[model samples]
Target: MTPTPKRTIVALAIAATLALAGCAPAAGGNAGNDSGGGETPTAGGTLTYGRLASASDLDLHTQITANNAFAIDKIFETLVSFDEHGKIIDWLADSHEISADGLTYTFTLRDGLKYSDGSDVKAADVKFSLERNLAKAGPLTLTAPIANIATDDAARTVVITLDEPYTPFLSELTSFASGVMPTDFGGKTEEDYLKAPIGTGPFAVSAWDPAGDLNYVKNEHYWQDGKPLLDGLDYVFVADDNQLLQRLNAGQIDAIEQVPAANAESVDGGSATTLLNSDSWAIEQIFFNTQKPEFADKNVRRAIAQTLDLPGIAKATTFGTARAASALIPPAIEYSAADAHDEKPVLAHDVAAAKQELAKSGYPDGFTATMLIPSGNSARAQIAQIVQESLAEIGITVEIESIDLASFRERFKAFDYDFMINSGQSDAPDPNGLVTFQADPEGFSNSYWTHYTNPEVTKLMHEGRTTPDGPEREKIYLEIQQILAGDVPYIPVYYSPNLHGTTAKVHGLESLPNGSVRFQDAWLDAK
Candidate 1:
């Protein structure tokens, strides 16, 4: 089979600036086409998928977790979506247009679109879904700039006006959070709608249990013709990685998500299974609470950053599957300075330089600090251990704390820790998704929890968002990255890769750059 083409984030950024008029459908229709000795596509088998965890909830507007987004992508349809190459393209919207001022966006729904319940999709539903997202104020509320939404039901069109020009607006619309829903939730209460939501996507929820398996059935009224070749999806929850791999190799499960890096080689070598890998938009890093007394000084923060060996940590954790990150933004996102490693060189590991930097700080002799990590994640725990050993050489004593995922989230959001290991991913393909959230002080509290701020960074972030010229915007982001490297608000460890394992029977399973697995077009061969 011919390999699919890949586009850099720069192309995606430039594409966002141009007005999309009467655009064609997104790519990836031939993702796993029968070629290279594969069996012909068949359409009536139910695929059993193994997952490490269960989704917290199916409410697209409220939850943006990986598990939830993966499930929601199939059950809901967004106005726009990213093709395999990362370009924003039309989905539910047959065509769209943007005004010269970049403040107005217009969309026309495709004819004959219907929800799983066979209800017609109209402009009013699109208007209501976007407006409701603004009111919820969730993490996916990238729609906060919308000033008003107007609909013309007769014309099947919706017009949205923003307060100002937001370059990432179109890319943000691809998120599952912006998924279209029935007006007033089909006249059902919010609680009732969430219990059994309906969408115009290729699949509908047949049964769901938070702690057990979740099942889905093909939507008979799906807008896409002769698609969703699989009869249904059976998601089996398997928390243990070893057992998950065993099941896949044993032919008990057709596919598995989140394949551990250490087991990638073994899974690929297995006769019945194959491993899928792609560049991921996520990054693993250690965040410093700038407000805390121990890290309040810039010299102290810089000292700690220089002491840890980023490349060593990455290898120890991901086992060559990931590369040491050179910038806050992952390389997959647009305007990322990740390629500037040689020129910028973000705090390369140096024991002697670290000692000198520490001597210049208020705590000349070093100090003791605690680093927190989620309890169940072995990769993070390994990172903490590596940091503990490295910092010791510089006379800084480090303590590692393991906390439950729930408690860790509460403390993380509350800014209650001195230092912590965490991984973050962009909601969209644009740099505005991660850069603005991390550097823009006016928004999300300086890197979303660090309490670190720079006046210049704040100004540049504003300029980058409103600037329409690609070259000019690139200069602004490059400057911001240089500033961030000097400030050391967070120390980037590695860029994570998206990994999945599938049995020989599975086909058409593609992983998006944002680390999402698309199963809508997947099919299975007869045993």
Candidate 2:
């Protein structure tokens, strides 16, 4: 069993995604007409979204993928949220304040707040939700700085005191995981809540017939007035890429995301569609089973990293929709490392140097290892074949194993696979998320894939998270990237653009730097 249940069974490593709060369209590509019909968003319509895969869980604290997170976001409202402008503002809160020292934060609930169950949303509920999530959630690390939570009913204000200053506290609170739950959330187990979730967002889970579809209805008690423009969302589960696209084309599904990297070209069949493409924070990598004694050496990981060709893989996999990822954060992150496009760094594509490193690692004759990948994905199969051919050049014989998604999940979480080309989206824009995934072996849920452990990485990630935004934080992450480059726990492959296909009728969908999509105001045009 995987140590962390929060990662979920449906968490796919192949998604071209980056995640945080809110979403913005990517800069490159055609950036097609995604702004639905110029008509004002109407109040009545059911937008049936064709998802790439089914959501295993809906509990925000446990939801791991962008699909689950985005769906859950519709049903759960956080104390804070980002506007379309990408600025964090009080969502459930009428107003909030932070002490000058940054150790104290206080917020007052918005007026006339009522959960779908008719229970009042109060300061106490915020405290309960925060306390519960901090104790048992994948996002615990982000909220670890909070020392205590206190609520004053008379003032209708909740105050949170942090053990230390956290500059990104507001940004972190805007996440789907920070969604406020009812005070009486009587779920003793995760399954308890998964069966029945209660939240105060724009929508509520109406019905979930596992094999058929999941439906969400309008939350009449939603605090926001006339928002979430649509009446409800009908998310249909479709696993096959071609079937999903066909459904969207035939109007069986209003919209669909995760357009397969390979099938992206097929969608442009002269249809009047809105193709939304965005720069993603996802980093595809060929991970090493560092838990194994044979891969315990950094030199060995570096050798494999140096042997592969990232640009060639990106070109073939994305069909010119992506750029080779030199850093973990993609071009969407226009802040610090966005400019640090380490184009073809040293030792990159150097077969001879990779062989030398392999020899130095006491494997002069190279080695033989099992490379596992999901069976149904042609893109992954192609990538696996390419990596195999490249490694063969250095005398490393890789035995490719194409397994189903279920078995692959088990093998990945168990650190049971020897070599695998896996991928994942970052949870946020700051280096904190990826750094956590890369550095700590047991702290973060995503760490299951990369069993990376280094005291320097741990320390640097801490500083990077806690440090105020400026040259210092940037310098810290830059140094951390250097460390990752040297250690090569996971080789950076390429950053692909996340795509969404829909008829010109669907509008008001946006993306964030982190690879997440929010349809808060998404509505379908009436033909």
Candidate 3:
């Protein structure tokens, strides 16, 4: 088993995706001609969603993927939440304050809050949840900067003490992993709790079909004044986008997640459908297992990074909307320095340099390596093909090994591949969120592959995490980005936008930058 600290680091590294809160559409009744043809519409309707893969687990802690996160976000409540505009606002907690040093955080609980089980939500539950994460409760455990947790029942307040000042701590608290679970429930294992999850969100699981769909109903007794506009939610596993589009056109489902870029325009062009565009907190990149023999050579890594055409890949994969990225940290973060940012350099078709680097690295003859990719993701497949063709020019052969979501995750976790196209959604708006991969030996869940252990980089990251924000902190962060750029542990790729397609009948769905959705203010208008 990985050490507790390393596991926590891995947990943080798995997702850097931001949330999109309260994202709204451009017009109303966008779903094909909203004609009230003498039919009375029901007040409550089921919102069916399409997902390529079924969730591995129902527990919010293990719900790391976008689809699972979307489903879990509806059922679980975070202490703090980002509004549609990406502003931090209270949700479970009425208010919160950070100490001057930024190591201590205090939160005041909201009154009348109760778990789905009808138990009062207290400060002790908050303390228990944070401690559970630090205790390595599951894959979502992220104890970065968190040293200890304490609560004062009499004062109705909770206090969190960190080992050091971390700027992104507050943002991270709003993550799905840190979502508080009920205290009274005792379970023997993770499997027991996941089968039937319970939380304080505005929705609760009414029924489930493990192989197909899960149903959730509104929490009428919710603490918030008004909530869960719809009567119930039905999550169906529709693997095909066309089928999803057809269903939505037929008024079967309210909204759908992950409308493929290939069909974004078509969906928008539909009379009743609208394409809702928002910034995805996710960043797509090609990661190399630095521990592997084929990737140990920095020359090889740099050569590959210098030869591929990122713009071409973005164009081919994301329908020309994505910007080719050069930096590891996405542009959303505040601490990222402009000079250190990767400028999406044009390697063009540099066969000569690629060959030369291969020669220098003692690989005079071509070598073969396996590339892992997610099954059914057309964009990943296209990029993999482009990379394969580009590498072939330099006497390198890549055998593509594509697998379903389950196999893909297990294989990647086992470090069984040489190269892979890994997507990241950063939780915090800092470069340190990226460092969790390199924090410890196999730092985060995603770090098992990077086996690139460097005392200097580690020391610098440690310093950057605790150091005060100033010229010194900026200089350290910029230096780290520069070093990682040159080292090429992962080849930075294009930043893709989060695209969604929904029926225009739905109103008040604000698109958030963090790529998270909220149904709080959503309402349907009968035409």
Candidate 4:
């Protein structure tokens, strides 16, 4: 089902700016209550948050989902973090210096640092955490250019030497994937640590159930004094958006993420709740499994791309909470081709052109296919329906299949679908964060599951990573986008804004540009 036409148009108009600015503040209502403005924060309540999905795992080094990152951000501390303005700032490290040649980095740890278990945090922990991530070759492997790590316990310093000058290295350090852990996981088994992980962040996990609620308690040893003003945090998993909103309206939960655009008005109008919307570097797209025989031909893929109207689909699904995406990189990130479509419209919708392209393929009369979408995501469900209708006009029969999140993820990772609607958000401010994950063939296991590769694109990705941030770097990414546009491995749909809902009593909750909600300083006013 689609949102009302009026709501969809209005949302589309407002979201156009979000597509350009990428990190604008909350547009429609109260941005969020901050600790400043002469209003002293009153702490002590345990804020209950309604999450749309359960975290697959809490292992910061291995897990790569946003659900896991949200929980891990609360339990772990990164060497650096992004401030309100999206600038990288020191967190665990008090100061850092980069060599003039850009191959070496030295960081000084904050003095008297202690973990949630009250163990002293040393440079060895940082070295161990990074080395572990490197060995595992997880998300950090693609962006981190580390060659060696040297730590000095006496000086409280860690020095890293890179094989090459990597521009996004510092920004990558801000990701939760780089979050620090004990040298030997606090002397607990991997199984034991996953149950209740300890970190130097604002909170520590007290209990976690894969199918139910996960609970946390304030970290007394957290270095940031008088921060994380809540007594604790309680995350309740609610799979459905409607149910999540109902819990928020019924005062059963304090806040929720991924609020549906159709329900944004209700939340904003309700006296008991508020809607928070902000620009995000998130993109929703339809990925074609090129391994499938039906989609093996580029002409067939481009035919499918031309058959659907991205703007209409985006409007119907997001209800103006997103802008129709023209490029893989959202406009907010550096080196994004914000005007690529204007220069050359590769994926523009044209049913006649689609028919012509199909006529040139093996299946001139079109073919039957199945589209996969994760259940409980209202927007994705709507997108599937819209795509089903659009494809029918060209003699293509599409059967929509909805599966649970876990099953959907497993299928996605296994390349087990003909095509699927999925979304991804940037982990850091640099364009390299999501671009490398989505486009680099060898970097992230065939572009994080698309399995589409181009020799030129691969070379450009490598050049883009080592090249300094300047006109030269921008040219490399622009060329990559142009190439991907013609290859049609994935069809860009829309750039989404981060939408969240909160009870009026909840304050100090802010949405980051990378689509994360900051609950570190959130609190509850007495209801």
Candidate 1, residue 485: how far the Cα is off, in Å: 1.8
- Model 4 residue pairs with clashes: 11-320, 12-320
* Local error of candidate 3 at residue 255 (angstroms): 2.0
- Model 4 over residues 1-527: C-alpha lDDT tens digits? 00111100000111222222212211211245544345666879899989988765888877777778788888888777775445566788877777777777788888888999899998999998887776666654434556889999889999988786666677767788788898888899877887888888889888888777889898888887766788899989998988998899999998998689888778888888888877787889899888887788888998989998988887787777788888888877766675767466866799999999988888888899999999998888888998999889888899999999989989988989999999867777776666667766655435657778788987886677667776777788888888888888898899888888988888888678777777767877754
Model 2 RMSD in angstroms:
5.8
Model-by-model lDDT, in order? Answer: 0.78, 0.68, 0.65, 0.77
TM-score of each: 0.92, 0.87, 0.86, 0.91
TM-score of structure candidate 3: 0.86
Tens-digit lDDT track of model 3 for 350-435: 66877777777756676898889987777788889999998888878999988876788787778777989977665534456556
By lDDT, the better pick of 2 and 4 is 4
Q: Per-residue lDDT of 1-527 in model 2, one digit per residue for the tens?
A: 01232211111111113112222311211123344435666677888888755666787775566557767777787776654334455678777776767677787777788887777777888888776666665643235467888998668888888787666566667677777887657434656666657788777888986555789887778776666677888888876666887787787787887676666666655365556676666777778788776678887888888898888988987788777877655555423253464653634678888988988896778888989997656678888999989989988899999987667878887878897877756554444556666566656544546677778876776666566666777787777777777788777788767777876677777665455556656777777
- Looking at model 1, residue 448 earns an lDDT score of 65
Tens digits of per-residue lDDT for model 1, 1-527: 00001101111232454664545675545442222255677888899999866765888877766768888878888888886557678999988888877788899888889999999998999988887776676656644367889999889899988887767677777888889999998999999998878998888889999777889998889888877788899889886667888899899999888777778888778777888877877888899888898788999989988888888888888889998988877887777898897456868788899999999999889889999887766788888998999999988899999987767877977988989998777766777667666765545444667877898987786677667757888888888887887788888789998878888778888678777777767888766
What's the lDDT for residue 73 in model 1? Answer: 79
Candidate 1 has an lDDT of 0.78
- Model with the higher lDDT, candidate 3 or 4: 4
Worst 10 residues of 3 by lDDT: 10-19
Model 2 poorest ten-residue lDDT run: 7-16
